[model samples]
Target: MESAQRHLRMALDAARMMIWDSELSNGKVIDSTVKWFAAGTSLLGLPPGDLSQPFSTFLQIVCPEDRDHLLDTMQEAVDKRTGYEVEYRVQWPDCSRHWLAAKAHVFCDEHGVPVGTLGIVWDITERKENEQATARERELAAVTLRSIGEGVITTNAAGVTDYLNHVAEQLTGWTLEQARGLHISTTLKLIDDTGAPIPEHAALQCLRLKQAIGASSHNQLVTRDGRHVAVEESAAPIWSDRGELLGAVVVFRDVSHERKLSKQLSWNASHDTLTGLINRREFEVQIADALHSAKQDNHVHALLYMDLDQFKIVNDTCGHSAGDLLLQLLAKMLQTQMRDSDILARLGGDELGVLLPHCPPDQALLIADQLRQSIKNFRFVWDDHTFELGVSIGLVEINHLSKSMTELLIAADQACYLAKERGRNRVHLYQDSDLRLARRQGEMLWVSRLNEAFEHQYFRLYAQPIVGLCGHGGGHDEVLIRIQPAKGELILPGAFIPAAERYDMMTAIDRWVIRAVCRHVQSVRDSLGPQQAYVAQRQPAPAQYSVNLSGSSLSDEGLRDYIIEQFVEHDVAPEQICFEITETAVIANLIKAQDFMAGLKALGCRFSLDDFGSGLSSFAYLKALPVDYLKIDGVFIRDIANNAINRAMVKAINEVGHVMGISTVAEYVEDEPTLAVVRELGLDYAQGYAVGTLRPLSVSD
Candidate 1:
């Protein structure tokens, strides 16, 4: 143990001496008096024997791969008398080889004869393996950097391009050699969405702050050919292992396709496919923005809700393909006439809305008039048949009085309704009372309630029998709608129907009544069959039960189809159904309504002109409507005995119906005298209290 300690101390002292001496040669220390390797002197795992033999045996213990080189290094050291260092593999006692570095210096006599050698052997196996592993990692890193799919670039602290991968070189049209060491701003240019240059120093600032920037920074890069390419890129500070900031690494991908797809999606979402106009949703957005701008700037904006008058006639007569073409042409015409700042949008169906920013009520009316004239002058050609078209416009202006976009639209819609009421193919401005009344009436709420009423079966049908006047027992019955008021007594059609028409709820109500009457006919088929058969010989087979249809419903493409489906489903003949459309509807959409009536008539269904003399009473429209009955207006009949004009009008209607082989029915014959007058006038039927009031005929009884 004492000897081992002494040897260990000697090894330590020798290592210290080698470390301190820079010029010591292999034999220089051998000739010195100080002992180098004593007999049986070994530190760590080295074997001790004859001192020189032990040292020589150490070199021979090197692995076969390194033995020759180690021997050559020893010979070189002895000949030159210089210090030597070499790393070689040595086999241990267990036959496992480990690497060692031997650094030695030789000490020599005056004639340069070798005396002794001093050396230190270090176990550098771990470090050597680590160096080989590091070399492998560097090679793998270079391959990965070049093989990356996305463009990659690295910059130094000065925002200069230090390295660029192959992809980066291809993206920028610059080779790695050309781009390296160039300022990043000069080699790789970035711009924003607007094609404005993005501050090149921004990335450097982020690196200096050791922060990360993601793709949202709008970094669009320009290629060498000046073609802009969309880029989604992220950058982060490149930091050393010890947390020292180096520069930045930016990785990016070309997003040109994605950008184009995004733009297409946006356009599709905001514009109508058929008309290439703004859609309802986009229209609302524009209106909201207009309202906001108006409020901020105290400017005026006009809203016009224009409905094509009798456009359904064109569609019904010419088919939807022609109708679509007409609409497209009308949109083009409107676009040609309107200012670029004004927005026109199809609000579905035959309705169109326009937003005119910075326009007042007077200017809005003028513009609306121009649109109306354009429509009136426009001739639509459907399969070589040319027809004139027109529009009824409702105009309203935004001011402090306007509350919301919806309210403004409603007001404009009411004004448009008034224009149609006054006679179509005209334009009217919204009155203050229109908005006030709409607000007070809560018309929209009523429309919603009407929908609920139909859903909940809250409506009832009341039949008024059109009794034969000349003691003839059989006559038809007209089904009238009776709406149950929310708070009070039941309301008749006269009281609520106008409101229904104003709000466009009449169409839905008309549908419900048609379905209801079909159901009723099915329910009472057995009881009413004989009576219907008796009346059929005198009138027409399949004795008609008149159900009034609104103008809106007549215009519905699905209406005729729906009614036909219901009739087929219920196994009811079409001849048993009589659709009563008012003279107003017939004249307003004469061509379309006539075609629709003709189509129904082709299916064996019958039609009647209800309230016959109420409208303009155009003989042309009456001749065109394909009607089987003419129900004289109640106003004329109520004053038939007192007013000569009313009597003459009723007589004229009766004469025309007779001449046309159409039955004439007089309505509102409240007294015996009025009924007697209607009978004397040769009217086919009379519907009033005096003409045998309605009775609830029960099937069981």
Candidate 2:
């Protein structure tokens, strides 16, 4: 018996447990013997002092909260005559709690009544502490995922849905219970921009690549309810502490509003805001494509450039509000005449362009005539006025023979202008043998010659004196530009002005004229310095040099600053300068013209509205311009001696100018009869050969 006990004690010592034996009576431990191992001593912080002690002494060290459970487990084991294992907390000598597991078997007699029990106990505190810490970390991660704004979904290594946050549930329209265990692609379906299902899902790609992945802006998420929502998505692989592939997490947000705004911006870039049609930039792109097709495929196409002939009359008569309505109505009417294969665009104000693909020149001419007739027959009514309209159409064939997009447009524009020149309503066709188009080509060549003149100082400045019709001495002279080539006759403004304006070269020419005029005025000022004392007593008024500005110069914001610089450089008085602008030029860009005129007028410079009695609403628009002189158009003055209508118009213009506190000047006064009529009309000034012929502008003049 002693050998058996010694072997059993050695076995218990090897396991680091303590062995205990108890004699039970009525479910109570009457006596017990205890054997302590290394584990037991470390747990209780005590050495084994006695081999025998009452079992009640050990119960005193048990945790008060667990003592009942331990006693009940022991009683059940004794009654059932079976083995029992129970884990309970124990108090050490320092009053610190530690976990203990007891395992034992109940010994019974033949009647199945328990008499004695044997058990083993060990310390399990480290395992219990680790389990509690792991539970806390998992709870924190779940709460964090739920609190975030972005939708988050997790999948397992097999790409099956494992978890989803509240935002994910809302976005996918699927509850966690319904999504769990399903393939991630089934729950988070994606479609491309074309609405084609994407086979490779972001989560699946992340799992396959074992790295992060992202979706493009064109990607969309399909919800459970069959709604497609634009969403920005990114996915990253979840990994274990040892770098093992565990799952993937996908985060996403709805980007529908952002994507919609982007689409709107793109549309606005290519379309005109007022007309809701493709703008000039987009029209040029289509024309370029047509050119490519003609060059590469030997295809034939046609382009029609149309300009409304009477649009300005309506606009100037009524206002821009009426003009805008007329344009919108005309656009709709023109669209009905176009085929599905035809492209129409608003090239600019009162100008529309048409592209007819696979159309020959003959068919293009017919279409152009039809459009012209439709416009000519249309009538526009605004407020209390009803007026007829007209259009000039230019047709140009596009084929492999076409030179370039720019040349094609220029040819079409030239033909359109030729149509207007030939008559008010007509269609002009551009061909290689067309004489008018040939003339246009000659004019285009002038663009280069004009540039050469600027470089080589081949330009000459002339002026004509504007004297008062009452015989008062006049010192104001209108400056005119002429191109004097090295070997040819002087080229008049009529020869190059139209071409310069067409090619947007007028602003540069205007600058040159302004600088030259300033320099001329300064030279005259220097030469007249000695004579100024005598002239100051006689002609107290300053001799103003009038320079004509083109319509294009009005929109040149830097022109104002540049003019200031030139005036300062030349040291010329602003009172000696007068800017003459035509009525059509000012009316074309009224706001810009007003601002330009106001800026210079503040500096003591004067403005003259040249060709004033031309527009249909001259009297109405006259009040809007700030000017010192109103130059009656030569059309009215050329026949004023005999034509009663011309005399009446001139009389009205002079009367209006006098009433507005602005001076009136008569243009094209070539003979004594015209001058006598101009003086009889009580006009302010007369500028023509009758008053003073054109002469070279020099300091000696």
Candidate 3:
């Protein structure tokens, strides 16, 4: 007995190490190093009253779900000297859980007959965690590469392209299968404006320099089938852990639309419609620049603020159509009169401003006179009405003594008014003091900012927990979007989404959110549990996510396909994701929303009607739309504990939803009482401050 105790003591030297030894027939335990597996004490199987049956006590600690498998495996190897090994979870004496790997070998007598079995138990909780972590890291890395909007390509040291993503294939007009083993020079054919091939390869340059290189906007890709696409590309050398060069990874984005729209959208955002000229906002910007030049470089510039004479009379007598025609013709006429460097803008109404850089006061007046004469000579014949327009020009000379663009503009405007008062067709020079420019920013700036954000990957994703009321663990977290400005400030979607929706930028934002969420889910899936965990009977750990879509997203003809493609690329099961659409959004574009919902549902995704009761015809649309969840609006859930009407409304909604075979999620639950009420009302999930505040999901998560 003392010898058996010494063997157990030797095994006890290692933490969490345990041993089972049989010194006699029928395999009685000599000793146990772990108290949790103490002899004659039932930690899981037999009651404490039965102390003689140590094996029965051991059975109590093995997790019931894993016990049968462990026993079967051990019994199979009980006759062999090769022994047996199995990993299974166990419940400790204190009710804690742990994973243990047991390795056992059957003891043999001198006559080569089986006697008893000896086994060692090792705590392998860390190893299990490490395996899960490794799985998550691999999944995350894969999804991140696949979900990025840009195309990625990797090449060997010899500059041969070996990989291409879906976007790259579409952009370069070559499939990965066809492009494999092709040289970068052949795969990427860049042409300049003069129709000549670019001199050097970006990938080669990165390898040679051992750094990063970028492609210029002046370069255009001549596709395999001869389509010319403007692209922006960057390449960096891939390195091994030991500081050796592996190859190069080239990332490129199809900026053909961006290049075209940067010029077109920039112009339309800050220009006049009736005339091809800058608008009031743009004119103000030029004046500010002219003011700065005058103050710093001592350079002189001139501003001409002009108003069309008899424009109101033309509008009233000849109708506004004739007035618009006359304005367009006058704009063309003024364009011919200004120098190449001069700036012309239709400020507002019938007003125009011309900025002449490095021009003296005399030259400015002469130019203004020329514009007036040109306008007077031009005649517009719209239908049968022939009309002539004249200009009253106000001129102001900006020098080192000039104050602000605002003061200069006002002085020039006042001079133009004086010219209107004097005779109405001549140019007048103004002499006045200057002060700062009045600023009024509009929503167009947000569109430009969003575009820039997309270009630079400046958006962030956040998540809020949607706790499950039932115990089986079957709810998805709601993903939220946030913007990171260039200056490093975090801006919530509420501050910018309205502008995004107004400018038709929601489609792009939606794509970004979906991709980010896919990558996020892929990387975190292991720790959160397998996406199909709940489906497995023995291991039921549910993990899923929900993402919101904008109303404008329904208008995107390709959104459904894009989502399916993302799921495929990220290797995510559609059942793991639920898309949330607002009631107002669904009703706004009912047909499109229905089509989108049906298409995604066909792909195995679930849908939820968010803010479900906000619309007047919520239940009517609810019948039309097939949604898995009906999220009760905060108005009915926020104070349901105190407000009887809210409580009644919530109850009605929950009952109706259940009748329709849909679950109910109550939002804005802010206290224990409200949570209690929601649970009492049979709500499936509750989300808000009391449940849990939103937490930012890191790349690590």
Candidate 4:
């Protein structure tokens, strides 16, 4: 027994030496003999528990959250009779929480009876905290990816989609399941703004270079519907925690709405709101392009400047509504007459411009003349009122002699002025000398004066009388307009009318004339009693006044409304009005003018074709014009007694008018011989100074 005790003591000493020198000082060991029990405790630390208690009882002091897992690990080791390992939370003496890793090996007797266990415990608190923090970071990363407004997609180096966020799914119309592992190009349908395919190489460049692309930077994406969506996008290389590149991440946003808005704003800036035609700014751009093309191709073109004659009268008399309608009609007519290659635009008000590409001087002149003829024949009617319109056109051809767009326009404008001067409803070609003088005179001065004339009431009305051809005693009056000049003597229609027309002042003038005529009728009506009233009514009463209209006015669809308003405002009966139009005006826009006249005629007003022989007068046109009276041209009447040609033409015209049940009037009847000739010719009325001079009626008349 003494010998056995010495051996045991030697073994204990060896074990102690081993434990003291080794790194695992906290290790414990137990004997397998049933009769012998052993326990080893750490000297470094221990929780405040009964040291004599079983190990399981001591483990119960660990944190409640980790107790179940630790218990299960210990039970498995005991049941298997094998090595055991566990990681669990522990409570320190100070109530602080800690993580511990405990490893134990179970020992059994020869008969498989459990005897003891050996283990080592280590404090793993720092590692546990690190793991928990990593878990939290991963959760936060996932949440962030899902919450972003822009689409987020991750792809492998091969450009295959690996992950997609909800926003990406919405933007691409593809779910994460559908996009996963698919080729990005095929799944996203990425394209350029012009619908061209975006190559995988470009995407790789963005990913590899870690660059960002913006919508204004020209990044584009295509949607499932084949619509190109402008996009602002960014890409960056995706990396692992180890600082190694994994793949790439891309973020993109749809900018289609913004792009559309920008385009709309651009369009509004360059186009007219009312007419939908190109605005002045756009016109300038087009002109510049045209000039450049002409210079490059060595081509010739023409710029036609058009002015509406007496347009203001329609507006003033009928109202602005009629004036707007007239402008629209004129625009349509100008468009109709122009070639497909031509560009026609309303410069403003009654001023219009036409650009004719590849046209030479001669062709330009021809076009201008056709335009003039068209304007000369237009007839506008408002309610029971009919008005005549005339257009003056100036044409200039682009040649080597032309220096710039402005110069060409100036030349064309000067020619247009000449057309008005020569008598409105005519076409004039630009001359170099005319342009030189126009530039020197700075004729824009006239434009300013015209604007002032309407504002200051510097316009006046003159009258011409219409007498009965068979000496019926009483005569009718035809109203004429004359403008008073600021610096010179009162200007005749022949002088400043051209300037007024060019400047779009005619509509205002026409309005004034209508108002003046209505006032005159009011004044005349107040003075005349019932006896004179009948005579007045029968003898083309002063109540029935004839007013001329511009071609622009005739084409105006709203003319009827304006006339009705005017008649209502003036308290004049529709029958008390007679609207005179030229035959040329009727024939030019026969369809439009006929429609206008028919509308007015429905209101019980009368129509007369003035200067019947001067324009394209046909029996069909005359019948269609719905005129109650036909005025013979004064040219034929001036020499009617002697000139057989004149007499024959007059006789023929009279016969045609009478045959059509239209009353014919002979103008320029200065003497008894002219009257006698007109009487023999079966003329209806005669108007000239020979019958009576035109004079303003006195308040007592």
Residues 260-345, candidate 2, lDDT per residue (tens digit)? 99999988888877778888889889989999999999999999988998899998999999999998888888889878899888
Q: What TM-score does model 4 achieve against the real structure?
A: 0.42
Residues 1-701 of candidate 1 have per-residue lDDT tens digits of 99997787677666432221212234432222322243223322456532333344454566788887876786677678777888788777667777777787876778777655566655677877677556544543554475489777777767898777777787887788888988877667788999887765445666767798766545678887787788777767765433446677777778888888998899989888889998888988888877777777888999889899868998889899988888899999889999989999998889999999899878888888888898899888777788887788988878755688887777888888888878889988888887666554666666676776667666877777877766654477888777665576776677567668788787778877777878777777645678785674476455558888888887888888888988986667888878888888777787789778988999998888889888845676566667888889999999888899999998988897888888888989899899889999889888889866654422221
Q: Residue 254 error for model 3, in Å?
A: 3.3
Provide the RMSD of all predictions against the true structure, rounded to 1 decimal.
25.6, 24.7, 30.1, 28.8
lDDT for each residue of candidate 4 in 1-701, tens digit (9 for 90 to 100): 99996786567545441111111112222111111123223322353222344344555567787777766766566667787777777676667777667666776678775556655555677877777556444643664465489887777767788777887787877788888998777656666666666555344665666554322335576666565667766666654453435566667778778878888888888866556666667776667777887788887878888898889999989999888877777677668888888887767778888888888888888887888888878888888888888888888877555688877777788998888878878888888798766644554676776677777767777778887765544346788876576677776776666666666666666666766777776676667898987776666333256787765667666677878887887666777677887777677677888888898888877888888787644677665677888888898899999999999999998888888888788888898898888899878789887777766532211
Which candidate has the top score in lDDT? Answer: 2
**Better model by lDDT, 2 or 3?**
2
Tell me the whole-model lDDT of each prediction, alpha carbons only.
0.75, 0.83, 0.78, 0.70
Sort the candidates on TM-score, descending order: 2, 1, 4, 3
Residue-level lDDT tens digits of model 3 in 386-445: 777888999999999988888788889878877877899989888543211111123576
Which runs of model 4 end up more than 4 angstroms from their true locations?
1-147, 192-202, 208-210, 216-221, 225-245, 375-388, 439-701
lDDT score for residue 449 of model 2: 94
Question: Poorest 10 consecutive residues of model 1 by lDDT?
Answer: 16-25
TM-score of 2: 0.47
Collision count of model 2: 0
